[model samples]
Target chain A: MSVTYLEAIREAQTKLLREDERVFIYGQDIAGKFGGAFKATKGLAEKFPGRVLNTPISEDAMIGTAIGAALEGMRPIVEMQFADFSSIALNQILNNAGTHYYRTNVPVPITVRLPSGGTKGSGPFHSQSMEGLYSHYPGVVVMTPATVEDAYTMLIDAVAIDDPVVYCEHKYLYYHLKADALPKESFPVGKARIVRPGRDLTIVTYSAMVHEALAVAGELQRDGFEIEVVDLRTVKPLDTQTVLASVARTGRLLAVGEAFPWGGVTAEVISRVTTEGFQLLDAAPARINAKDTPIPYHPNLWSEHRPNRKSIATKARQILQE
Target chain B: MLQTAQRGKKSKKTAPEKPASKKGQVHERYVEAFRWMLTARILEDKLASLYRGGMIVGGVYLGRGQEAVSAACGIFLKKGDVFGPLIRDQAGRSAFGEPLLDVVRTYLGSVKGPMRGRDGNIHRGRPRENELAMISHLGAMIPVMVGKLLAKRMKGEKEFVGLTTLGEGGMQTGASHEGLNIAAVEQVPLVVVVTNNHWAYSTPNEREFACANLVDRAIGYGYEGHKIDGTDLNQCLEVIETAVKRARAGRPPQLVVAEVLRLAGHGEHDDASYVPQEMKAQPFAQDPVARTEKYILENGLLDEDKLKQMRAEIAKQVDEAVATAQQEDPPYPREEDWRSMSTDELIDKPSF
Candidate 1:
């Protein structure tokens, strides 16, 4: 059966519900036949009656309750309608849930599903990439699943984790990325997957940017210069060893992401590589991120605003020449 | 100790008339409530001492004047009920089943304690022991308790109810509004108590909100609103018990804005110069602890000797707890622990 990225997420949740009686899904309009805002939880409510709950339109309450349930030993997966709206519950997520484990030695096993990244005309209030912001905290685990397989596997892993996990699943990849079937067993979380192997330069990216990086690599392959692309499955427990090892081989680095440039995942990756593996790099590590502006409403402005294959390939060429 | 009269600054508005409580029969249950309140007072008095003596590095917050409200709620909540106890609810926490040693170890920042020396004294609770811990963000715990109660009900724990506390000043926060609104919409078995102490730090009742009483806001959320005398332990328990029963019966959530008095400064730091002298004496004049003591004496439940014995025994317990906590080492999170403690043991199973 052909599996879409969104379908894989649903399937993974289905598996979790069937396997663990403690697992449940909670969100606004995610119950009964309506599925969810994005239909990420379609059909499961029928299968798991009381487990799939539709909460009131209160983001703070949704997250706060999920944390309380997690503390009570129930695994709750909360779906924030839009990634941008997650700011409403930041106090509960960043302060309460994140600090609970460290402060009280009680693990809050909650997976907050954030439908992240920009979509055409999604505007500032609907579109955001918040993995970097959550990763800045001490106790949160940030997971960005790039592929359908990773989406399926990583979600299950997130619920199994003892700490609160911010699962930043890209909105763009929900239907676009597809695979023949879900992985029976996936790689352990926090390990970067090398999408393409090359010697010219290493492009470290995650989520939607992984696809763009791969596309850039394919286009550059015609010129006989091999490009390496690494997909970070999880951002917080970043696979620095993989990034450094790839950079060690390529000697050139280009970190890319769809998030804002200021203090973002791209900045974090570049900072680590430059500071820790300074001698391994032949040139200064560079990164391509979205312009430091709120995501606009128009498709043209949005297209130019984020880092695409065109901008990434151009930056790669400049860094290769250097 | 500061004289009772000098506790809080008096407000321009006069205190509400005391509720006509049941006259002079202290039941066994009321005696237990008094004991909890007394324990809380003794513990807080020790905490203040530790703060003054430099034994406690963090600031001390006590529910000195509001023990009746806290102990009443704590005593009424049954086994399946989940509660989020605030900084001023140690009596509630104790009554909710948290051991006295856990309280001492938490405040002392003992390395061998449940908190592992990570959090301060007031931020401690053992959820594993059925007590939900609270953070400094006031009104944040209201919704958390709602969620906990929802989970419990969904898991077939049908008799489960929830209790959460907030101050009058904290009632203005968006989290509190959102939490109460959802609890009403969902018809969750939740009881939210707003301790209307008439001041949000230095801001008085008039400046705190335009509403006549904080409990009236419950009307906007479509729930039954209550404004009870927080100083009367018997009246407070009777009101809360009805709400608790209504909640357990799957009725809509209840909003209780209990009028209490903040007997001490917000923390050990503030001397409460902002509170009017008249307002400060009001709580002392209507002190719940003293009132309960009077009830026990008038009803022949206990004489002065018995009360003194109870106080002395609690003092000994507090002293021993402090002694044990002091011998324990302070928490020191090493570099290795920081690096290795990235994820929990459950997720990091295959540790490659």
Candidate 2:
């Protein structure tokens, strides 16, 4: 039987709860049959007993409490119902959890699961990719898993991480992505994976956008071009070496992301490649992201707002020709 | 001297209690709380002077008027219990068992402090010992304290409570509302002490909140509410100790609102000329340090000679801590490790 990306997340939590007594899930509407907003925590409350708890609709307190629990040697997983709402808890996440170890030598081992990326009509508030926002802060590890295997393993690795981690699980990838079975092992976090390897051009992306890049690679393959797709599993400790090596082989780079175009993961990737791998580049690095405006509600506008396979192929074609 | 004479006359009119066995315990507790208050007062006074003399960097926030309430918040907490002290909580920090050296070293930027010279002044705490180093955000520590208690509860630890202090201004923050509500919902043994010092920085109560009293918020948050005269040591000690006991007894989270006035400016950098002279004449503006000293003398908890000796000893301790901290080297940029993340593998190597 196949496991969906969402089930892989639930399975990771199940494994963590079974193995470590220190592991506990705390979030709003995530306990006792309610499961979660997306049902990512379906049946976890019953299985773990008191290990899974429902919290008040308090994002600030959710993260603050997680930090406190982490300080006391408990690994807490806080689920923000949506990535947009995490803005309310940014102070607690960036200042409290992010700065704790630097100032006091106390590592806060808390994983904040953000249901990120845009669904068809999620609108501005519900549809947002916050990896770049969280990655801007120090002491936080930002993970964006694009596959079922990475979703399961990286979540388990996120909880094992000593520093605070923002695990951005794309809402769109919940059921759309599937795998034959959960993998026994996967690449560790902070390492990028080359989903499709080629030599003509490199398309670097993560999360839901990685699939879009892969689709673009397929579309371009019908032509004379061969494209390389590198999935950046973790955005913060970006696998610059893999990206640079891919760029060194392909000589062209196109960074695509679902987040806004303004200084996000796409921009960060292109900046790093241009700065560190200037000699490796045969053409100027390019990137494609969502429009600078807020994510729209209409499915047609939303489709156009975010980078898709068509837009990624168009951008990739231009970079390859250069 | 005139104020002391008037207080002495008032003490004479009231019957001085002989130290019975039960009263002796109460007296000892009062004296212990007073010692913390006194030490905090002396240390902050030195810090203010050093700041004025340009010997210290960063802001110096003094708990000049709110010592009674601050000290009471920490004094009742045991070893296993957690304490989250705010900017004006040096008195509480001391009573909660934080070292004077930690305070002095942080202020002087010595690398030997609890913060390792990364954070300075009131932001110092030993989290391993359940003392949370507070960030500048007000009301943020409330949720942290709740989480600490929740973790302890999950670990099957019992009889421990977590206490944190916030200002009247912090009571209106969304963090306070959310944290307090969550604590109540989870039934965590947490006590949140709000010291209504009449002003949040320069903003008065009228500008900060519309509630008649901050204690009214406790009801909405499902907390057992109590109020105290923060300048009065007897009331502060009695009310806070009771609130803490109720919380430890597994009662709903306690919210103790103490009424006082911030006698000093928000920080040493602020002159506080914004405070009207009429407000300064108010009873809540009375210095908790002097009031506690008078209460000790009035109740015969300790004699004038012993109080004098305690003050001298505390002053000497403060002086030595400051000297030792000043003699130690500040963190050198070249020698600083500067790694924020604890995971060595996750940390990115410096490109330069």
Candidate 3:
């Protein structure tokens, strides 16, 4: 049976809950019958009865409690209904949990699952991808899983880590992305995977944008252009060496992400490439991100809001020509 | 949702039945509470001097008049209960078993301290032992306390309880409202003590709230709210003990709004000239420590010589702890060791 990205997330949580007595899921409407807002925690709550709890509509409290539970030795997986709504709990997630381990050496083994990226008219409030915002914090590990297997594995890994983790799961790839069975082994945390290899230009991306980059690479193959793709599984401990090495091979780089065009992961990728791998670049390293505006609510405007295969391909072709 | 507005009886000297044990008996607990209150007062006074003398960094927030509330809550809390201490809770921290020397070291920002020089002043706690440190965001800790209690219950310790302290000002925030509501809905064993110390930094109680009674808000969350005269040590202790008993029995969350005064400025920095004269006069006159001392002296609970000796010993201990802490080096984790110290696993050298 083919395992969809969303199903793989459920399976990973199931495995973690089954294996560790301390693993529990806490979020809004994630209890027995309601499952979750996105069904990411559907049947698992029924399977692990008492472990999965339905919380009140208090994101701030949900995260704070998760930090408290983590401090008390329970590995809590807190699900934010939407990535945008996660901002309500930013105080707890950023200051309390993020600074806990560094200040006290007491690990806060908590994972906040933020269903990220734009999905049709999910609007500015529900469609934000905050990987960059979370990654900026010191004690937090920000994971942006692109594939079905990575989604499953990275989540399990997030629970095992002592520091707080922001698992930014893209909403658009919930069912669109699939694979033949979940893999038993996968890439280690913080390592970028080169999904496709070429000698002309390296396309560095993660989450939903990784697929777009791959598609762009495929389209460029017809024109005798070879484009390499690197999927950054985690954003905080960014895989700078592999990215630099990719830049070295291709002599051109284009970083892409669905987040805003501010000081995001894409900017970080290009910044590191230009700073450390300056000589390797045949041209200046470039990046394409969502427009510097609030994620629009209209379908057409929202579609135009984030990076797509068309925009990515155009950006890649420009960088290759340079 | 019982919502009676019961002002605590006026502070009067009463000799209750003294029990056995050095710290568990009624009179003993009262004596210890007074000592803790004095210690917190004296300790903050020293810290304030240190800050002024350039021996300490960051600010010093004193518990001054709210000692009875903190001591009562701390003493009533049983073993295994997690407590989130506020700036005005040094007495509670002491009653919860945090040593004076450790507290001094934390204030001094010593390298060997619990925070390892990462933080200073009141933002220090021993989470592994269930004594949570306060974050600067005041109301945010209530839910965290609820979370700890919920986790304890989930782990099969059904009897465990969680407690936290916040000012009346923090009650106005969304976090405090959400935390109490969730605690009620989840039926967690948690008690939130609102030390309504009449000011939120420079803002006073008049400017902060318009509610008829602060404690009455608990009724809206489907729980009884108790308003106690915080300066009355005996009343504060009795009310907190009752709340603890109710929480341990799996009741909904309870709010104990204790009306107290902040004798010192918000920190050692402010002169508190903004406080209205009459409002400050009443609570200052009813200082918890003085009330406890009067009861002890009038009721013949402890002799004058022993009380005087106890004060001298406490003063000496504080001086020594400060000296020892001052000598210790501040924590400075080397860059090479950052990986091992911060993360769970040192990454294998990244494959190029």
Candidate number achieving the greatest lDDT relative to the actual structure: 2
Q: Model 3: runs farther than 4 Å from truth?
A: B1-24, B283-285, B333-341, B344-352
| Ranked candidates, highest DockQ first | 2, 3, 1
Best by TM-score, which number?
2
DockQ of each: 0.46, 0.76, 0.53
Error (Å) of candidate 2 at residue B200 is: 0.7
CAPRI-style quality class for the chain A–B interface of candidate 1: acceptable
Candidate 1: residue A248 Cα off by (Å): 0.9
Better of 1 and 3 by TM-score: 3
lDDT of 2 at A270: 83
Tens-digit lDDT track for model 3 on A249-309? 9999999999988897888888888877789999878888999999999999988889888
Mind giving the per-residue lDDT tens digits that candidate 2 earns over B1-352? 0000111222222221232337678888888999999988999999999999998898899998989899998999998999999988999999999989999999989998888789988888999999999998887888898889899999999999989988988878899888888888888988888899988899999999888887877767767778788998878887788778877977777788888989899999998889999988898889888988888888888888998899899999999999899999899999998798999878854253
Q: Which digits, one per residue and each the tens of the lDDT, describe model 2 over residues A209-310? A: 888888888888999789999999999888889998999999999998998888978888888888888899998888899999999999999999999878
- lDDT tens readout by residue for model 1, B310-334: 9999889888988999998887756
| Correct interface contacts retained, every candidate | 0.47, 0.80, 0.56
Candidate 3: residue pairs that collide: none
**Which order, best to worst by lDDT?**
2, 3, 1
DockQ of 1: 0.46
